[model samples]
Target chain A: MARKQGSHSDITGPRVRDAALRLIARHGYAAVSMRQIASEVGIQAGALYNYTPDKQTLLFDLMRGHMADLLAALEAADLQGDSLSRLEGFTRFHIRFHLPRPDQVFVSYMELRNLSDENFAAVEAMRRTYEDALESILRAGEAEGVFAVPDPRITTMALIAMLTGISNWYRAGGRLESDKIEAIYWDMVRRAVTA
Target chain B: MARKQGSHSDITGPRVRDAALRLIARHGYAAVSMRQIASEVGIQAGALYNYTPDKQTLLFDLMRGHMADLLAALEAADLQGDSLSRLEGFTRFHIRFHLPRPDQVFVSYMELRNLSDENFAAVEAMRRTYEDALESILRAGEAEGVFAVPDPRITTMALIAMLTGISNWYRAGGRLESDKIEAIYWDMVRRAVTA
Candidate 1:
């Protein structure tokens, strides 16, 4: 009986998160209810408590999960070569990583205001770590004389915003393929920072 | 009686819009309700119908007003000088214009999915026109051999994304002043496309 219950949780947990993400992405976190999320997941509303304590916790978990996933993926990318090559690698990886997860990207930015202050600070710390990765690359580039960034911190924010903004308009079968888009962006990014 | 009614509307109209923008920006359009907006405006819920037919229309009107205002302001900006200088003018204008209206900027992007099909198309057309203004500058620069933009349209999107992103983190008394921020961004923009 215990094994069966554990197996049920394994399937239900992911389904709960998936439903919550879709609902919250379509409607704001404040508008979506646990009942609706449970309905979407084909579970009883009471059963949701088994997976999450409350809506805020669920929101925090989704956001925390996204940031953790981002950091993990970036670490696994194992960026190599000089700063120039690493910058290119980072640029392409950002586009590729974010393009497939539009809902996560949308919710991550849009629902940030809904997070509790402590949750916000926690999420922000993770985000800063990600930004610092790129800043380190820029600092290295500046030292190597391959780049001439005036302000690495501001430049990091600008470049991330530029790259993430792609999720707003990009479609799979659109006018330009993702590779083409990546190449164009990489060229612009390269030119923007290079001496 | 007619004069009194007109005067009342003149006051109420803006209050309603201001309330809607704040609520919708904070909670998102889908999450916000007509009753809440009416409360925010210090009016009866039923009276909201007298001003706008429905929540969707209210959302549409706010979005339309924002775009219209943006276009009119751009037109009145009357940017002069060469393409490079005009680009500088645009960069500064965009940052300054959007910084104070973070709510409008937030709603404009976040609530696009909530807009009706026709409303979405209408907003997109206005947005395209704005993009065209920047594209024209890039084209002129390329034609004059001053810029090396391989794709003017993509470059226009990238530049706008980078500029508008200032709204995300900018504050009134932050570390850097707006003017300093503008100059730094302008330098990056100039380097990005110059030959």
Candidate 2:
């Protein structure tokens, strides 16, 4: 079939992803169906197939997209300066990046089990890449005698988990602003790693 | 119907909760159906209701049970000694306790959104009690000039999040034994709060 100019695909593509992310985050990936996603997008059930082959692919795409965006943002964050400053930057960046995207964060962590083996590996690799960014900072700090981490790998996972945990309880217009939360977490991260 | 001794209900009650937990952890609570849970327990669909009135009650029971068991175990831990020792006790205990129950930890955190408001409040209150135990340690440590926690509440949440996070990646027969992992985490936790 010949494609028309300004086709619905371009317009509906983002809506499909958004609806799928919201629904999957709310009800989980296995329970959500194509019809439900399509309805959420205000499209026909069969039309969803035009965007993705199946629910699995749709899920894989959403996850991969999130990771890809995260990595790209990390690169753009231009984390520079001494190891301490770099670690601080990374801590603040992680909280800011994840706090607003509660749905993405929840779906990314919770729905990994539902991904196919191949998809799971791809997502895991991206996650490892992100963790490596922090691990390198710890390694650098250790070499500089600025930090005394017993295990950089373990510390990497611990810090990431701690920072990401904020998404679970933080809300907008709360007692602490994002910057205040970031500063408090940065202090703990610094103390946890420093000699 | 009159109750029968050693009836299927007696045998199937635990099986139902076990199957429900496993299924809910794997596929999420919103996705698992009563029939599926019953089938997993090798029982008929109608008979499933004999164990629990509905899925909401089943979920509430599972969550409440997890919290109750957690609180009871915390009391049994009988953490003692100076504030610093108590803090170490908590750091190690949290990791050891959660590592063996990854499914429960995962479901408890991930399924909070699926819980009804009343059920969620009950679970939250129980969680607060657990957090309070840790907060008291921090408070005592700070008062004794042993720990320099800027905000005890925030530190409590951060430490608990960090310790509980071990379950996300730790596997039995992995590179590090539970004791080793606990030691590494205790070191970090100690560093994170010490003066």
Candidate 3:
């Protein structure tokens, strides 16, 4: 790691990915082309090939990165209590992680269509893994007699949509800060599923 | 009475819209060109201008038609009872009405970026009107002390997302029928919001 650190190759990869993320977020996954992305990064269109083989790979990379970031945030949060605290932590972490990067969130959700079938399966698997984590929390709450949801699947979808919808509508230049928006979303998700 | 006949104009407006909807649904709005839609409709590219002045207009026309259909479905449903019945009726109607037109549903959710400002504003207004109707139901339920919601606006987004998510994944040839899917969704929405 020490030998290769801070070399020209090291910086190019992240720069290319950042430019691709912004373009894909703004223009949608399908609409952005390699030429557009390379231009944004101050490189020739052919240079992008060095970092990622194709546009689909770039989108897959960004979304995969976001999902891992999300799960990491949840893990880092110190929730040391009952199921409710876990639920609260999950909701807050989700909204907070997603809201700041609307482009990433939009790309992650909207660009799934452009991924190759194999790439898509991998991305969706990671996403489903996160969802299962949330489901387990709900199931544990139910077993502990703290949650009384009729169906965990529906509750989970509803809660996620409630949180993700905030990202669709949340704007940094707008009135509400990200924390307030997260709190508002958390309130709705908690009430919708809480016993 | 003498003029009670169909408009057999060579450029059938509805037919063109249907073709564009399917094309845009398969390829995104930006990928779709007016010539492609005209070709799909079995007409010369130049002739398409008679129906829609431009591609954006065509996109707007399809979306407006979908919104009109949605609102009409909502209005025609029996809302004679309390807020709960009204909300249930909406969920059922939404699933039934949208399932058959998944392409339109996809276009409705995904094509807003393609519309001009005026058309986008019109679509947004129609969407808000529908949401407002749901908000009214939530308000009524809250007044009756039956629904436990922290925020009507947030709850409305969740309910819509939960129901709309069905179209994203539902297949026409699946084991479940549209009615059953609607019923399952109604069950989910009913339990999630109502006490």
lDDT of 2 by residue, B45-113 (tens): 998999999999999898899989999988999999999999998887788788999999999998998
Off by over 4 Å in 1: A1-6, B1-6
Which stretches of model 2 miss by more than 4 angstroms?
A1-7, B1-10
Writing each residue's lDDT as its tens digit, candidate 3 over A113-195 gives: 78889988988888888888788888989889888766676566656765676765667878767776667566655655666
**List of clashing residue pairs for candidate 3:** none
Q: After superposition, how far is residue A16 of candidate 2 from its true place, in Å?
A: 1.0
Q: Residue-wise lDDT of candidate 2 within A1-195, one digit each (tens)?
A: 457555788789999999999999989998899999999999899989999999999999999999999999999999999999999999999998999998999999999999999999999999999999999999999999999998999999999999988888888998889988988999999999999
Per residue, candidate 3 scores C-alpha lDDT tens digits across B1-195 of 445356544337778988999888877887778888989989899988888889888888889988988889888885768888888887887778777887887778777877889999999999999989899899899889888776687677767776777765678887667776666567667766776
**Model 1, residue A131: what's the lDDT?**
95
- The lowest-lDDT stretch of 10 consecutive residues in candidate 1 chain B is B1-10
- What CAPRI class is candidate 2? medium
lDDT (10s digit) by residue, model 1, range A1-195: 778765978889888989999999998899899999999998899999999999999999999999999999999999999999999999999999999999999999999999999999999999999999999999999999999998988899899988998888888898989999999999989988997
What is chain B's TM-score across the candidates, in the order shown?
A: 0.96, 0.95, 0.93
Which one wins by lDDT: 1 or 3?
1
For candidate 2, give the DockQ: 0.77
Give me the displacement of residue A160 in model 2, in angstroms: 0.4
Docking class of 1: medium
